[model samples]
Target: MRVIAGTAKGRALKAVPGTNTRPTTDKVKEAIFSMIGPYFDGGLALDLFAGTGGLGIEALSRGIDRAIFIDMDRISVDIVKHNVTAANVAERAEIYRNEAGRALKALEKRGSAFSLIFLDPPYRMKEMDALMLDLAERGLVEDGAKVVVEHDADHVYPETAGAFEQLKYARYGDTAVTIYRYNPVRSEHPMEE
Candidate 1:
């Protein structure tokens, strides 16, 4: 797949050879960025369960200050590193060869917070809720930061989780994109105390 916009626009990215990973389509990427708009300037980003690193790379190309990509598969991590270097955004990127949950915990320990977080795990994994809860508990997402999750359209997500509020959801064939934002004020006073 190719980057849809920004500095790396039109650049080709290498994809994983097997079906273990699913790269986001150009159309979906375009739609996602369109929804995100131009607010990414200098923002920190995180890519969970990152496959080819396409989504995170797109954020970097669009002017995000830095991005951290996490993926457990060695092939996927290598592909992401190669793609980042090829796109000339390696200086603004970091890759971690670890599972999503462990990576999130480690990032929390580092006291790193992201303005944007992308979650695109395998369709049948059903790990989205657990990951979201962990992120909430660990404070990995900055206040007002947006989290975009890609899942099978048929999958159901929790209505709410801690500080995160579901902003919008859209369907593209079998895939569904859900956007969430962390609101500390609301979460800190659940009963308006």
Candidate 2:
């Protein structure tokens, strides 16, 4: 895959060696970033299940202040590191070799918060629901922060998870991108409104 925009535009990125990782396709990536637009200004990003760190790297390229990439596999972690370094965005990245849930918990313990959190776990893991719940319980998402989940189009998330409100879903062939947001002061509430 390759960096699609910003400072690192057109730069090539290495992928995880095995089929264990499902890197976001260039078309879907472009669509995603286009939807999110230029709001990445100095925002903090978390890329869970970060195979080659492409999503996080894209955020960094678009001016995100920092991005934390989490992946359990050693090889994937290495590739992510290499890609980050190659993209010249290593200064704004933190690579973590840990399971997605554990990494989020650890970030919570460290009092870390992110404005944009990207979840792109393996298709069959069925971990998105629990992860989104945990993020809400731990307050990892700041007020008005956005959470974009990438999964097979058939995979459906709960209508509400704690403070997060599922805003919309976009389908790109076999992949679906679900966008969520947290609004602390919204009287409507996720479930009740």
User: Which model scores highest in lDDT?
Assistant: 1
For model 1, the superposed segments whose C-alpha errors exceed 4 Å read 190-193
Candidate 1 local Cα displacement, residue 182, angstroms:
0.8
Per-residue lDDT tens digits for candidate 1, residues 41-115, read 688999988899999999999989999999999999999999999888999999999977778779989999889
Which segments of model 2 are wrong by more than 4 Å?
187-193
Residue 104 alpha-carbon offset, candidate 1, angstroms: 1.7
Clashes per model (N, Cα, C within 3 A): 0, 0
Candidates in order: C-alpha RMSD to true structure: 1.6, 2.0
Candidate with maximal TM-score: 1
lDDT of each: 0.88, 0.87
Alpha carbon lDDT at 59, candidate 1: 95
Q: What is the Å distance of residue 16 in model 2 from its true position? A: 0.9
Cα lDDT for residue 124, candidate 2 = 89
